[model samples]
Target: MVVRVFHTATALANTLAADVARALRSNPRLVLGLPAGRTPIPLYDELARLHRAGRADFRRARAFNLDEFVGVTAKHAGSYRAFMRRHFFDRINVPKARVDAPRGGARDVERECARYERAIARAGGIDLQILGLGLNGHVGFNEPASALIARTHRARLSLKTRRANAPLFGDRVSAVPREAISVGMATILEARRVVLIATGESKAAAVHQLVEGPVTTRLPASLLQLHPRAEIWIDRDAASRLRGARAAALRRLRRSRRGRSRGRRAAARARGSR
Candidate 1:
């Protein structure tokens, strides 16, 4: 696992977008596992900008969304399908046929999930998977549990997950679906490269735990620790509570800068150069 901290949400977004664009340039047939959430909105916009400018070509790329609301159709206003179209697919050059997602409203959601799993495999598995961290430490709706499922499956959305999704449902928690079909942790770990982005102070605790805590199932995102190429990308606000690794060095740097500032002030005072 790798942890990268950026100065601001925009910085993280830009860097991540560049990384994706570069990867796509290297492999036009790249398969992407995408996420839909507040954190990825800017990323999708940046990728669209790259496509429009002809900097990155996605014409041969294929994409699979990480999950969708179980009760909503793909055309539903709040479905992840609509979310991706509005935020990403509609703006890129990738053909509609190549971008698919779990059918949230399928008559048998579990079957739809299994189908999605197979579809990903048929596409030769995901080359790159981008994720957004949930406040409760989930990735792709794989919530904190005693054990985790390895294949795409129907999942009961946690109350906190529903609340977090409320904004997309007209800011009404009651309007958010209680169930969803999410790609499994094993699938995400299987991706050749995985990057999880988080921003804002609300995610500080979870970010801290992901980088500084144990690899326990209670914190599902921590399981990324086992992935060879999994990366946690966060902004300063989200990394604020972290205490080890680069976080400790950042704190020390700040204190050193302050000390130098104080020394300069004292020297100026001694020279009567107020």
Candidate 2:
């Protein structure tokens, strides 16, 4: 697990876009697991910018959304599929055929879950998975007490989650679905790389729990600690509660600068000696 702090959300988004662009350059066929919400909006915007600049291409890439609300249709304004289309797919070159999300309105939800899992397997799993840290520390709707090693499945939405998402449903808590289908913790852990983005003070507590607290189901994002290549990017506000983490990041930054300075000085001295 790696935690990186940026002064602003835009900076964090830019850095994440650079990483994603690099990954795509190295492998155009990369499979990306995406999350929808305000936190990743900037990142997707940045990627769209890169695409327009010809610095990135999504034509051959595949995308899978992290989760979808059970009662919503793909065209619903509040659906994750609609969110992705509005924010990413419509802006990028990725073919519609190559993008997928859980069938939130499927009559056979259990079968839909199983089919989604199989689809991921057939794609050889996700190369990079993007996540947003929920206020409750949930990831992909895997709410608190979610099994540590579960696979793609249906889950009941917690009331807190519904309330938090109420604004998307026009501030009507009753309008938010009470259930969702999410790619499980086990499925997310299978990704080659995972990037989690958090911004603003609203996310500080959850981000702190994710980075510094114990690995427990009570804080689902804490499970990222077990992922081999999990990277967390947060703005200063989101990292406010992690004073020790902030200090450590600053120290590392200083050390890196010192190392670069010493190398340049050594080169200058070598030239003078010559």
State residue 35's C-alpha deviation in candidate 2, in Å: 0.1
Using alpha carbons, what is the TM-score of model 1? 0.91
lDDT of 2 by residue, 1-274 (tens): 9989887799899999999999999999999999988899999999999999999999999999999999799979999899889999999899999999999999999999999999999999999999999999999999998355389898998999999888789999999999999999999999999999999999999988898889999998999999999999988788878857566775566567689899999999999999
Candidate 1 lDDT by residue in tens digits, 56-154: 788899999999999899889999999999999999899989999999889998789889999999999999999999999999889899998888998
Clashing pairs in 2: none
Q: Scored by CA lDDT, what does every candidate get?
A: 0.90, 0.91
Q: Which residue runs of candidate 1 sit more than 4 Å off their true CA positions?
A: 252-274
**Reference-based TM-score, model 2:** 0.89
Q: What is the lDDT of residue 216 in candidate 2?
A: 95
Give the worst 10-residue stretch by lDDT in candidate 2.
245-254
* Reference-based TM-score of each model: 0.91, 0.89
- For candidate 2, the clash count comes to 0
